[model samples]
Target: MSLLPHLHRLPSRVILASASPRKRELLSSLLSPLPALVKGINLEIIPSTFAENLSKDGKTAAAYARLTASAKGKEVFDRCCGEKDKAVLVISADTVVESPAGDVLEKPSNKQHATSMMQQLSGEWHAVHTGVCLMLQSSSGNMIETTFSTTTKVRFAQLSPEVIDAYTDTVEPYDKAGGYGIQTAGLGGSLVEEISGCYFNVVGFPIRSFVQALIELLDKVKDKDDS
Candidate 1:
């Protein structure tokens, strides 16, 4: 059955609080299964200004990511809700790579940083976590928020210094978390020896999980309307 009708019936002003092209592409593709879903959506790509400098000390990777995502979502939700007179749904996400030794690895600060990150990941299994937040506000001023996370286990093939240098030299490693992108063809994708979970999670968003969560949230909103 087509879900577009239901999607359209809900709060139509949906916002994606991210500037990452990969995420934007993933989300647009996620809704593309339903013809015209992309066209129907009032999606606004407003990047969040939240400082993601939250300390990772004593927090699990999932918790850290989830918190960061929630903060980002809340920042955008507040801003959008203030401007729009209708109900708004804001989606935000944050992805991070956790080294085998348990250190959280975010985007590299420099070329040397990228090289070091590659060295840490080479021949080792690491966890990639993507945290998501959904903030929905009804026109009546009611607000609902949910947050969840997905983790993928990825193992990198043993890499020589030359290989690391070759990868870091390209533009692939700087913008992406973990200093690599699993979706990047030939270069970044070649780093992973194997992955134990959703491949899309490593790419930055978990579409399956997001779909399920959105359905559940929509149902709740529908019930409120019917009541």
Candidate 2:
């Protein structure tokens, strides 16, 4: 049985609390062998005032990712908790790029910003962190939340000004966290040196880690029911 069928067998429905196209594609691929059973809640990514604050513990990348995902999950859960559905599981995720210099690079806003980010990332190894949150509405309508995160090390080949300009001209780097998409034709194979971890994590979602986390959460929920 596929992932969706396995999930459907549970006593509730699965809800993805995000509006990202990449995440939707990843989830569809993961659930392809089963009947489509998951739904998505389109939630906006609000600018959090706390997003810019670096964690004093030095885990800035992981900390911001978790906080962002948790905020999104909670927002969606708050809106859907009163439903009569047997169970509603909401998944929210956030991804960020951390430079070796310890600076966090968010999505670029324009061509100039993209150019600047590309300059900083050129010939450097950076870390990509994605935080995932799973929130479930219990049979009794109470919400329970669990969070986990994954990090991938990525290295970019040295890029010339011409190449960066060419890439930025065609691709919409403004929508991507690092001013480049590792899955896109122009960027993935040609510009990236290598990846030390999950490739999908760099694309926007970390499917393998996410699946593991989801299964673990489900197991815990089942154990509670058994007890």
Candidate 3:
């Protein structure tokens, strides 16, 4: 009666095209009761040249997230289709924090960079945007990609220089976007004041939206097979 039993009967395998441990953990929750239903594939995270233009008009945080996720999915789909695995499903995602000043804070490179990012986020409200893409390879070897994005309004508490420096010394901020991990030490729930949207989105993945999308995708494939 579990979802995994049904998913196992599908025609293709589900592959997560990301190297992020956070993503791997989140996706694992989706493929539950079916051991190893999701496999992680390390795909390059570089966006295409076209993706850079997605925010040319300075769109909302949600728009930018969706666009980035779609781009990453397409990139991975192109690479996977070239192989013999014609009926594979690839999931890709990207997360970014948009500062009030309109700058996108990505993963920081070092302690100094992380400290600077934390300082900018201190005592302010910022937007967390996460874009998720689902790419499925058809029987005809055609790849179809669908994308969606989620936005969470996060408000951080005012941090003294000592607090920022203390948090930076921990490992929790280095591997996450905007140099902070919301689920753990990223100040989302513990130190953050408020959030306006999906809680999981700030943690890294939007669980509700992601599950709904997966179900819809599977239904489409089922209908096609029935025909």
Quick one: best TM-score, which candidate? 1
- Weakest ten-residue segment in model 2 by summed lDDT: 40-49
lDDT of 2 by residue, 1-227 (tens): 13453554344555667667888778756654333446422333323222434453655877888878887777766666446654767778888999888877888888998888888889989999998888766565555578988999999999999998988886568777877788886564477898999999998898888877777666777666566
- Candidate lDDT values, in order: 0.86, 0.74, 0.72
For model 3, what is the error of residue 203's alpha carbon versus the real structure, in angstroms, after optimal superposition?
1.7
What is the clash count for each candidate, in the order shown?
0, 0, 0
Task: For candidate 3, write residues 1-227 as lDDT tens digits.
Answer: 23443455344566666667777777676565444555423323323333434553666766777777777767766765445876777787878898767678777878899899888889899989898988776565555557888788998888889888888787767778788877774353456878899888887888788877766776776566566
* Two-way lDDT contest, 1 vs 2, winner: 1
Clashing pairs in 3: none
- Displacement of residue 204 (Cα, Å) in model 1 is 0.5
Worst 10-residue lDDT window for candidate 1 reads: 31-40
Weakest lDDT window of 10 consecutive positions for candidate 3: 40-49
Q: How far is candidate 2 from the true structure (C-alpha RMSD, Å)?
A: 4.0
